[model samples]
Target chain A: MLIATALASVFIRDLFAVIMVFGIYSLLSAGFFLNLNAPDVALTEAAIGAGIAPILMLGTLALTRKKWDPEPHAKKSTHTPLLPLIVVAITGAALVYATFDMPYYGDAEAPSHTHVAPRYIQESGQEIDIPNMVTSVLASYRGFDTLGEVFVIFTAGIGVLALLGFLSDGSGRKYWQFADTASLRRHTVLHVIAKILIPLILLYAFYVQFHGDYSPGGGFQAGVIFATAFILYTMISGLQAVYKIIKPELIYWTMAFGVMLYGVTGLVAMFMGGDYLDYNALDHHDPIHGQHMGILLVELGVGICVAAVMMSVFFNFAGRGIRLPEDTKEGGQ
Target chain B: MSVVLGLFNYWIVIALMMTGFYLVIATSNLIKKIIGLNIFQTSVFILYISIAKVKGGAAPILEEGTELYANPLPHVLILTAIVVGIATTALGLALIVRIKEAYGSIEEDDIREKGGTT
Candidate 1:
């Protein structure tokens, strides 16, 4: 099924169909992760890959669909695909051939299993005392790498803002006339359901955030899920209500504050005489407690930054002031 | 037969990767290219998780009485990678939007033929 979708998406020119099928590809990826005994990874893939990424892609299409779709200029089909096919086939054959030397699938003695993973699995029980060893490794054993990951996304968020921040075409609207309602009047059911679902989604995201220490979700999944609640509300209820609630300025502040909190937690650890990001010093009475405290702090920081950044990016993308069909009519009225 | 049973997963994932690679190189549509990139990425992720699989192992949660577990390292690594993948995708899509705005078309051939910055 995953293979079929990938192949279909490759040939499909209808951008909307391609995005939908590509979402299926990601959902399949999540199921693939679950079959391999990686539920934590599966959860993140399902949420971001299938859930948020497609929505963002669709939001983009909403703006550009007018300018690009339905086979404009039929002559451009002149490009031949034979050269790329031969190249991909050779590269793929090489990869398959190299796999002959790899350890058999599911071999317990595979080098990846033989090394650091064994320690993470066996000792994380006592060392971090977290039920989810993936979280223990993500937040404690490999804390520095996770810190770098947060920074990578932080930089990505900034890149998105720099590119789209000044994009408003200045129809002189003080804010989006999101509820400058034409299409929204028809979405009465959508508004009511969003009202009910948004709070529930936010509650689940909260559970996923703090409960991550014990479960499949963590800061990464939780943050995106949290931001998703708002994105959902925006899609249904319109951006005007959401922007009034979470000022654009507030989202930006929270984005920086989340990064600062993560950085400051490390500094606080350093000032207390432990290494940077050393949670043990946070509470010397019990190193385990310190680990818990430190993981909680960093995860909170990650959750905040990720949620804020996702919202910020969505707002910028959707709020490019390109004016949807109904939005364009608002100026005339 | 033994080799097929042993290495089937890798071979399939490699095929998927190549499909993505083919889409990236062969297609002119920018959105299709991004989708291709994503497919390629997800396949590589599957490859890693397959490596991390231990026969008869449980998920990596530290449960009582569960002695064998899949490798947590790749889960930790790929978990972050998945999020980073979206981040990069968003960045790429943002660039594509700007490209559309400036060049008036996302097609590579169009951009090149129109001779940029009209």
Candidate 2:
């Protein structure tokens, strides 16, 4: 069933259908994770991967065409398949061989179990006072990688905003018209639901942010939950409300602030006599306490930046007016 | 029963991931490609979650007289990944919408043609 859904997603002609299929794929993947014993990851996957990504994809599809024209010469020629076929064959063979050499599924004796991972797993609870090993790994031992990931998200948000010309003076004009009475009435149900859910989601985000030490929650989940609330607001109330709530200038500033917060936290540690991002040196106190404080502040930075960047991207994309072909609009049911 | 379920599930997850990736690379429609990307990502979630499972283990919460529990680490990791995936997808969709408005079609070929000719 999953294979069929994936195939249909790729092969489907209609863009909307494809997007929906992608959503299904995400949801299924989340289910797969839940079955795998990773409820936190499953929650993240379901929310971000399935829920938000598909919605964004669908919006993009609505703005674009339903069908693609084949390349002019390729349609007339028959020479493309042979090379692709051979490549697929060779790749398949390589994959099969690699599978054979891989450690048996869930083998406790695997090399991964014998190395730094087990040590970290064994010691993390005592060192960081966190039962969740993933949080400990992400925020401390490999905290730098998390930093890079946060920056990458920030960059992507900035890139999308630039692409939509959000910096231009005239870009915000069209989207600012207050929601019409009729449209508001029509969307009241959605609006009410969003109004109820957005606050809860934000509260949950904070819970995830602070509860990382004990449970399967952290900065990324919190950031995403925060972004989800705003996205919902934009969807139900239109881009104008989102703009009013978080003006473009504020969005840019907040994004920068988030990144700056992260950098400053690290710099403070450095100034206190530790290496760059050495959170343990933040104070002349116990190293673990310093580590805890540093991780908290840094995760807050990540959550803020991620949430801001995501909202900015959503606004930019939705703000770009759809320019459908005249015929499609006229011929609509 | 437990061992068989674990092995079979992993294999299926791996298969889905590969197939999804293959489609993403091969498809022409931008939306289809994104769908493929989602499929590809979900597979990784499966792999991570599977690693966290422990034989005869329950949920990772502290419980009376229960020492064995599934690892919560992977679950935590997957949760974050899920959120990121959603953000990426939402952004991707928004881009597609704008692209449609600007170029009149979501098909990769059509967009390329317009871009090239212009």
* Model 2 per-residue lDDT tens digits across residues B1-118: 6455536655666667666666655555667667767777777777666666665655554444765556655655565555556556655665666676577666666677789998
- Which has the greatest TM-score? 1
Fnat per candidate: 0.82, 0.39
Output the lDDT of residue B102, model 1.
Answer: 70
Docking class of 1: high
Residue-by-residue lDDT tens digits, candidate 1, A1-333: 889999999788789999999988899889989999999999999999999899989877766656454868578464589899889989998998899999999999988888888788878888889999889899888889998999999899999888776535555453354434224636778878888999999999999999999989889999999999998887776677677798988998999888888888888888888999888888888989989999999999999999998998888787764345553466459
Which pairs of residues have clashing backbones in candidate 1? none
Residue A141, model 1: Cα distance from true site in angstroms: 0.9
Best by lDDT: 1
lDDT of prediction 1: 0.86
Instruction: For each candidate, give its TM-score against the true structure.
Output: 0.94, 0.82
All candidates: DockQ: 0.84, 0.38
